[model samples]
Target: MIAKIMGVLNVTPDSFSDGGQHFDIADAIQKAQCLIDQGADIIDIGGESTRPDAKPVSFKDELVRVIPVIKTLAETTDVPISIDTSKPEVMLQAVESGASMINDVCALRVNGALETASELGVDVCLMHMQGVPKNMQLSPVYDEVIEDIKHFFAGRIEACISAGISESKLILDPGFGFGKTYEHNLEILRCFDEFKSFGLPLLAGMSRKTMIGQMLGDRDVSTRVTGSVAGAIIAVQNGADIVRVHDVEETKDGLMVLGSVS
Candidate 1:
């Protein structure tokens, strides 16, 4: 499969690495330009932190954080802009502002999220998370992890289809570490190819996540870039169609040398 490189633009004060870093619109725009110059195929922008144990923000606060950046990125970048949110209102406003994609970690379960996506007919990414960000990893379990994830995706796909969204407009993310132990994350990583059965693009966003931190015993997110690239490469080699990353230039360089990837 042809791999899509989704550059991440975290516009939150609490996102794991870029927390409070790109909260400003100017910084966010510059970063988006840099990502585009680095060969990012899409820019996935997130307003919420979604970090485990993180406090939830209000709708106005989230809207304040994301809308400007999405508006600017949509206008400036040739690459498609994806608003990474579960809020239906945010999705609507983002699309109106020129976003071409919706990357919802909650799989559009939030009331009206699916409807907004279907109504807009924009590209949507449906992800698998066991629970909300604040407490997801508190104690996540599964009869079988991969099966459980695939099942979740299956149900989400059905919901999207029922809402009149076509299969080609959807992409699936296994939600690594969103509500998983490092072991659970590794299990998904080890057998990532199994997700190919879904017959859609598979997006693996492991950049600076807890899985790599746990594996290397490094809690610092900045240092995890290499580890993230390694995971992305492995996932792509296995069956991933997209690698959502924070480090655009590095990931682009690494993927090019993989030789087998196209």
Candidate 2:
């Protein structure tokens, strides 16, 4: 029955979707407010583009792109802000700037990231990505996708706990498109409840992803709103506590309808 929505606000020029749309600080702020008005429970701000083949941005550049927006939103709205990054430095700065959650694609595998999150004392989402964004889609392989990611999450959770982070502060994301083929993504959705065995919150972010496109007639990113909402609905029904999404209003409406029925 959980239908928390974490609206994506990517402030990069090449984020695969709505990238350049929010590169300007004012525009990003406006978009954040729009997401908030649309019923986003959390505004997830990403500075760098993690899309496949995305060129890497310097740490300083990444910080510049996200910190101002986080600071502005923190001052203007009380909504929980999530910083989506893999770097330890960005995590620290984002928290200091008022981000309550760290949505890391690398699952804190980077050096010092676990310790940093522990020190910051914020909620952390550990996502399962097979490889880096640059080459993640290049022949990704897995003997059992769900089992593989479950093991990865277990190890990362252990690492976080070892680093003095409380277990209550952890969330898990299956990473629908980070490094998976169409079949792999579907399998994760089908077996999402198995991940809840850890008794932690589960976040599913299949919004406007290639998997949805591939499943729905190769629709373009902008034309995938219905598919994204469908995926979000399926994720929520399959034991997801949170649905990271772009079409917040549509997803919210869908969840409302679902709530009345079930």
Candidate 3:
């Protein structure tokens, strides 16, 4: 199946990629429109930078950053809007502001997150992260990354269901760079089909990440577009249902070419 594209719109100055590029609300709204024009199926607006060793943003600040963009986009676009946040308050306000999906890196494990998502009645993307963003990459370890992620997804799915969220409303993200080494990220991509056994849509976010840089001779984030597109194609070929990306036009072009021959 062809994978859907989720355009990355970070309204923060600290994200690993495209930070400070759209920190302004007007710039963010323009970027969202550009992504839609490039054939993005969803727009993911993130207020906080969840990159490794990233400092946390307060609830008030985060809400102030993302809510306006979400509200404006909702008024102007037909594409689904996803709020990339783990905070329950943000989730609630974002949904109320017309965000249709909640893309949480914490897999709704934070206190009251699951309940908030459940009550909000929005689709949720439960991602697998080894640790908190502040220290996720510090000596990361895993006992069989694929199996561990599957186990983690299973537990999070059960928890979502137990909290009154419909099983059908949950999506799973493998979280390629969060708390993962280069090898772990590769293994997850190579065995991505294994996660399809759960019968949920899989989301892969590998655009312009360190994993791509590691393979491209430590290329800078801005220079990793080609590698990012190649990695995104591999992930789609391996059964990724949604690909979160920084280069929306390039990645969408790649998917279109691949789709024609698939």
Indicate the residue-level lDDT of 154 in model 1.
92
TM-scores for every predicted model? 0.96, 0.99, 0.98
The number of clashing residue pairs in each candidate reads 1, 0, 0
For residues 55-165, what per-residue lDDT tens digits would candidate 3 score against the true structure?
Answer: 999989999999999999999888999999999999999999999999999999889998899999889999999988999999789988999999999999999999999
> lDDT of candidate 3?
0.94
- Model 2 lDDT vs. the true structure? 0.93
Score each candidate by Cα lDDT: 0.89, 0.93, 0.94
Where in model 1 is the C-alpha error above 4 Å? Answer: 260-262
Residue-level lDDT of model 1, residues 95-161, one tens digit each, is: 8998899999899999988888999999898989998988898999899999999889899999999
In model 3, how large is the Cα lDDT of residue 158? Answer: 92
What would the per-residue lDDT of candidate 2 be over residues 141-221, giving only the tens digit for each residue?
999898899899999999999999999999999898888999999899989999989999999998999988998889899
lDDT of 3 at 15: 93
| Candidate scoring better on TM-score of 1 and 2 | 2
In model 3, which regions exceed 4 Å deviation?
A: none
lDDT for residue 96 in candidate 1, whole number 0-100: 93
